[model samples]
Target: MRAPGAALEVALQAHPDDGFLLLRTARGAGGRPQDVEITWANPTALRLLGARVAPPCRASDAMPPDVVSQWVARYEKAVTGPGRSWTNGVHGSSGHDATGSLYSAAFFPADDGVVVHLRAASHVMSALARDALHDPLTDLPNRRLLDEYLGMALTRIARHRHPVGVLFCDVDNLKWVNDRLGHAAGDRLLRHVARRIRAAVRDEDFVARFGGDEFVVVVQDLPDLEAVSALAERVLAAVRGDLTLDAVSLHAGVSIGVAVATEAMTAAQVLSRADSALYRAKRQGRGRTRAFDTALSREVDRRLTLEADLRQAIERQELELAYQPLFDLSSDTLAGVEALIRWRHPSGTVRLPGSFLDVAEETGLIVPICEWVLATACTAARGWVPAAGPRFKLHLNHAACHLGDGQMTAHVQAALDSSGLDPGRVVVEVTESQVLTDFDEAHTALSALRALGVGVALDDFGTGYSSLTRLQRLPVDVVKLDGSFIEHLEHRDRDRDVVRSVIDLSHSLHAAVVGEGIETDDQQRVLRDLGCDLGQGFHLARPVGAAQVSAML
Candidate 1:
């Protein structure tokens, strides 16, 4: 029976200001006791306002000092009419030092003499705010809190104000921890974050967790980037302390990104710069700090966007394949076509593999992208094979991870059969890196494809890890020399020597070599004279779809 009222009380306590809104009030001085006062204000604000807080606290207590001034200034206009005037300044907790977040304000009646009404609802509001501003597990401020502080801090410093330093830090692979140990263990690691973060910064400096394992330290009154860098180093040292997980000694490192407050920037701009610097440090092999710079931000941002764009492309199904002809150098005839995946965006722009393939490889989307490319290319090949002539080939590059895919062998067989293209007419090009990463799987897949009577080419041969070693054991039939090897033909001592060795190596292994990037007749003549068996480049024929190939053949 008491539960109903208790719940009501809890609700009211949660948002005392709602009482004014929920309870009907009379106009002017003749109103009832509760209705006469504002509803949201509560004991907390009443205390802050230097008044004894009463039952059914009014909502007016949320007003801050500045807001109270505005109200008092506008009191004449408000009391002369019916509607309440919204206060501007919020009343904040006395506990707030410089970095504190919650600031409460109130709605007050226009009359100067009208009693101040405090609402109990601000407590509820404050609780909700605290939750939103902080990470649940670590109870540390997230990016939002950092933004508010950095904004105010910079604002204060604008009029020849004091200097400030910020340390942006990231955890090295919390994902690995979550995967290997468990969420509990990951939470435990994050729980110890504050102490380590604090230990790295001075008492006067500000610290907050950005998210997951990333944190930021904003230090006011810093002289320059050098001082800021010192804080980053300290943060690295502090977080790198050995951690014990299930009786195992584990070491964790902090990749600190630092951005100092500047007069020309907003809070968002400064933090963004710091994030860029942090990325640079991570790229430099983690466990260190890098100062923010414009060039660094651009490169990091470009790579970051490329990675993100590649992932989004998969979800959006925004990829296509273009066919480029492989020339038989001796006959000057188109022997086969390389099936290169291109990102044809919904936005109507086309991008080459170089723009995003590395991102695909890193994020493991290479497998799916490769799968889509092979299937689509084979389908197109089937449509044009009869008209384009017999034994025309579509060469598709496979990634290091694709070999490990359980259904890839099946995917290949299906693509070939469905397209009505013979397995012999399709060439599976495996990049050197792919073969090295999972040798056993690559061997198995290649052997299976060979059994199906498909042609397989080892791509970018000289660039892979132990290419020659792989050749001896793998089921490779052709070797496509990477373009990097072809770039060095002019210097015989270095470039020519490397090319000669690779050619000799490929020949010794009995694998036909295809020189890529033969843009000029000189490059082509030189490559063919050097005993290269096949060639591919613009000078032969640029990559084109089936329609264009119709005219060429």
Candidate 2:
């Protein structure tokens, strides 16, 4: 005690902003630190607390009603149980907002009673709270806090076997909101929407702000899907009402997707169904609610299973390439072939890319599948390359996400370099919409690949936004007419006109055009007449293996 007293003088001299007090106590709680007693209060405590010498010595005696009265038990447990601890609470002080931190140094055996070394820890208390559970601007529960509360709610509901529904809420036009109005207005809109939703739901319902205008509402003890849909209707009504934010009067819309938990499903599965429902809502038009459908969910589950199978298909030697010839317009000769991926199942039946490619792209299994296709096509097309005549390109379709990634250049480069095939024989076909984002990066990657003598084609043109703009910007050598635009061209003159314009536009940009999905003789004749450089479809020929391409060559 004598040694610590001498050191206390040095400690007080070196430190500022910190309130200090000497505490002593007797052992209690079975071999625990002694129950605390306060001996002296340093000048820092008085200054920090803004408390005058009011005759009482214990810091708790000066605490405010909101501080001690509200949170005494939780805070007290931390204070007296452990050796040293701290917490945030308000103090009874003027000139300040009464926020401060309290730390009990030690609970030691004392002559009279226990003492907790407390000072106004308002700043620390506020900081702890700010970090604990909120999104700064909206003051909504963040992901971390959401998980904590959800865990608690789950525990309670599980014991009672009560139902809980999770709704995945996303603002329908946040990007539009940001672009049209401004980020400041966007922030205000988000906060405003958050407040409205909180007010719309029952007090017992849990609302958490998941990232970027997305909120997850957990409605506890719900009975059925209809009840959840009703809540979604209330949310929709609240969000879609005309409102003003930052002096900009506009209507905001939201699409809510609801997933109700069942004994048959996992939490992740439930959440995924909600996400899918959300997508369905977006498709049906925003500002609507879509409840999770079992049939629709089964499709999703099947797709997920297919996605998992596809990732290993290449390594398992289950994936193979099937090429369909694209004939030249004027020459009536085979100009090139578009390589399509096929899954050769154990049952000896063939699986088309349409059945699995979307899932592959979504699950990020497309990259490796594309790699296998590239390598296999190059290896198998070696014979077809020489006799397939000049300008016989092996067009390979790549996913949009793969094209957008800067890392794709390396994968492509590696595939081409390792395949020991001439780069001129292979062409990377990407959709026009894929390169729209970060065009500079796409340009850089495409240019690097082109420098290696690889060709680039913008597949699925004339369907997405600014097709002509993309044609001009991209370093594309060809444009494949999207099948959606080309499908009904046999009789639809409007479709025929759009296709003709796209072909002419492609030629104008010094890029050749290929009309895909030409499934009838009339479509073929019209495309040939229009000078569509290359044509691919079930009408001309079905997708065949590389050996078949060699035989055709």
What TM-score, over all chains together, does every model reach?
0.53, 0.68
Query: CA lDDT, every prediction?
Result: 0.69, 0.70
Best by TM-score: 2
Predicted candidate 1 versus true structure: per-residue lDDT over 1-553, tens digit per residue: 0122233345456555532221113245353222233333334444544433443433244334454344443333334445444343222222221234333333334222232333444464777899989877777777898889888888877786676777888887676577667888877877776778887678878778887777888888878878878877777788887898767567877788887776757887788788878877876878888998667767767877888877888888887667889887888877778887788876789998777776677667777776677778888777767766564677877665557665667778878877777787888888787777657767888888888888788887778656466577877778888888786565455776766777787788786789998787778887887888889988788888767766666
Each prediction's total of clashing residue pairs, residues at least 3 apart in sequence or on different chains, is: 29, 17
Model 1 lowest lDDT segment of ten = 89-98
- Tens digits of per-residue lDDT for model 2, 287-387: 89999877888877787778767766766889877788888867778777888888887677889878888787777787777777777777776667668
Worst 10 residues of 2 by lDDT: 89-98
For candidate 1, the per-residue lDDT at 275 reads 80
Rate residue 534 of model 2 by lDDT.
85
| Candidate 1 displacement at residue 166 in angstroms | 3.6
